[model samples]
Target: MVRASTPSTWLQGLDIPSQLFGTTGGSDYELYEEDDEFVLTIDMPGFETDEIALAWDDGMLNVAADHTDENRGRKKTYHRRFRFPKTVDDEGIAAEYTNGVLEVRLPTADSTAQGTEIPLEG
Candidate 1:
């Protein structure tokens, strides 16, 4: 399942049952580890690349965007924070925004996964 970038608190009061799912109901981003790197992609429409800001700090990634439309007198804002499981190469981190999509890659320091896996008891 694709998780939403930010939790939709405004939809929580809706009558629809799916609204209860909030951020978990739909997907606007994809995250995975490949080739010794962690890749995170977020689909953000109606915002320019310049309006978006990405920052990495202390094993956490922060994504924020703000857009203002003076003609329509409206403002849009987005903010999300993510914490990775393993140690990442901070100097090797990179990001790109194109066609309203943001993609970030963080190189892993080693091949081992951070935590011990729990055995599934069915």
Candidate 2:
């Protein structure tokens, strides 16, 4: 017998339940700050290196994947959304995928410009 999901259970899984009724499509992510960069980690169970996409536009970072696992007959969809802090640097971003996890490194602006000095008395 197939069991149906309740409203509460469904809402709990969604990225933005209040706005979008069901669980956020696709995967879940974690963001953290290190010494000189902002890091984003996402869980992508069955994705390949080529299936993932990462981009930065209008000061926003977008990560997505089109993954399919035929053996398990699983087709996952995602619509998760997140907002970054103003301190995050949009340039000098890098991403990598390994062991079903995607890691993104965004260098902080201050960190990127650490060695440049201006001559005020020229």
Name the top lDDT candidate. 1
Q: Where is the poorest 10-residue window by lDDT in model 1?
A: 1-10
TM-score against native, each model: 0.72, 0.60
lDDT of each: 0.82, 0.68
Q: How many residue pairs clash (N, CA or C atoms closer than 3 angstroms) in each of the candidate models, in the order given?
A: 0, 5
Question: Against the true structure, candidate 2 has what lDDT?
Answer: 0.68
Considering only N, C-alpha and C atoms within 3 Å, which residue pairs clash in candidate 1?
none
lDDT of 1 by residue, 1-122 (tens): 23545546686566568646655623678888888889998888889888999888899999999999899999999888888854899889999988888999999886566569989998
The regions of model 2 sitting more than 4 angstroms off are: 1-27, 71-73, 111-122
Top candidate on TM-score is 1
